[model samples]
Target: MVVALFNLVSALAGCVLLVVAGGDSVGMPNEWLARTPFPSWAWPGLILGVIVGGTQLVALIAQRRRYVLAWGPHAASGLVMMIWIFVEIAPLLVWSPLHGVYFLTELVQTVLAVLALGAWPQPFFARMPRRSRTGVGNTTDTPA
Candidate 1:
């Protein structure tokens, strides 16, 4: 439950960042992303944010299912967010003559993504059964 909420928050935050940092007018962190070659990638990031955030929202609705389909989308979106942050965003922030705000925001968002994935209920929640493995063959209870 907590993981989902964190993911949702992070996704929303990321979306806001992408929207606000659409162009190169700003400086440092914000401008860093905007200056990247494929400026259009921001749109994908925004879409990913919506997907991740929506996944969490659905998780809340389907609590009793033990596992929800949202997990896959959440994980994919997280990966995309990480790629954008590290590959495109980080370089600019690191090399450019920018302030620390961009780095700090990146750090916080990274932590949130880590926590969300680490705390996810379980990857196999839906496919696996609850029963424990006995590891005993009915034909031969004794060791061969």
Candidate 2:
């Protein structure tokens, strides 16, 4: 429950970051034409915000003891968030010229968000017992 709340909060924060960052430049047609000059961080941040927000929101709604869509997307989004964090950090570490305080800030935020999602309690479906070959529920036997 606590983890879910954390994820929700983090998702909201991500959305705020997206709005403050000026959204995705690539999403704007004029960007490709070079008519508008937006920071490179805009696009990736916006993408990350949407993905993370959607995932967390779904998880939160599902946690409320309601029907949840596929858990696959939620898990995938968590993984994507981690990947996005790496993507954000890579340039800063590989290219000294890109060093900035914002890089570290993003790193911390991403780490926190990942930790929150990791700590969330497993859904009942995830913890449910599987059926054995004999057609009985197998709570302890490992599948071969």
Candidate 3:
């Protein structure tokens, strides 16, 4: 649910950036995208944002293992947000108006991490949990 919302917002934000930011952060040449309507350079970053967000959302919904929630979109978002929170050196570093995007990304990332680490099926929402590997939940353990 959280990932989905984030992805949706990300996709929309991409559109906004593409249209508003122009070619400043698009990442691709205006001639490449061939859609003069948008700024052009902003395509790379904006497109990437959309792809990551969109895929993350799909991953969240399509997977059965609870771990995916942690490693999939949630993890991706968290990683990017974490970096943005610290570095603030992303492509859009030049854009002042959208600089707030970093904080917003960080927020979603934090939320997802909390859900996976504290909520999910137990440790490793995206990756595997330690207990599951040690067989602690099974009855094959020796009593101390």
Candidate 4:
């Protein structure tokens, strides 16, 4: 839910960026794109809203729906967010506190997904009986 909200806000922000970029390029300066391969923030805004935002939103939905490999999307979305931030700063050649905030957020998102996916010794799914032939249950010897 947190990731979904983040993505939603990002998408809205991106859309706002698109609208602003398409217009007078108000708060955002065209000079920022001078070092990059863009004439304006229009393309970046679109990519943010569509690609970054879209992928995260889809991941959130997949998680909610209990889709198979939902964690994959969650992880992927985090990667996208991190990558977007990296690319965003590369051309600008400057840093902002918000970048650190967002980068950390996405990193946490990815870590949480990995933990939820049982990156540690916790079971991701229900355990079978102790004496089961498959022997895929938890290793702890404590009695149920």
Give the best candidate by TM-score. Answer: 4
Which pairs of residues have clashing backbones in candidate 1? none
Of candidate 2, the 10-residue stretch with the lowest lDDT total is 26-35
Report residue 93 deviation for candidate 4 (angstroms): 1.0
Q: Which stretches of candidate 2 lie over 4 Å from their true place?
A: 21-40, 68-74, 94-144
lDDT of 4 by residue, 44-100 (tens): 788888888888888988988999888888888899889999998887887878889
Residue 135's lDDT in candidate 3: 73
Give Cα-based local distance difference scores for all models: 0.51, 0.50, 0.53, 0.78
List candidate 4 segments past 4 Å from native.
21-26, 123-144
Cα misplacement distance, residue 41 of candidate 1 (Å) = 9.6
- The prediction achieving the highest lDDT against the true structure is 4
Model 2 agreement with the true structure over 31-90: per-residue lDDT tens digits: 432422345445544665677656656655664654444343445545555565566445
The CA lDDT at 49 in model 3 is: 64
lDDT of 1 by residue, 13-42 (tens): 666766666433233344454556545546
Model 3, span 1-144: residue lDDT tens? 554566557656765776577644655335544433444445545654665455556545544456544445565655554454344334323345344664565566557666655555643434442454667774435332
lDDT of 1 at 47: 70
What is the Cα-based lDDT of residue 51 in candidate 1?
59
Residue 14 CA displacement from its true place in model 2, Å: 3.4
- TM-score per candidate, in order? 0.41, 0.43, 0.42, 0.77
Candidate 1 weakest lDDT stretch, 10 residues: 97-106
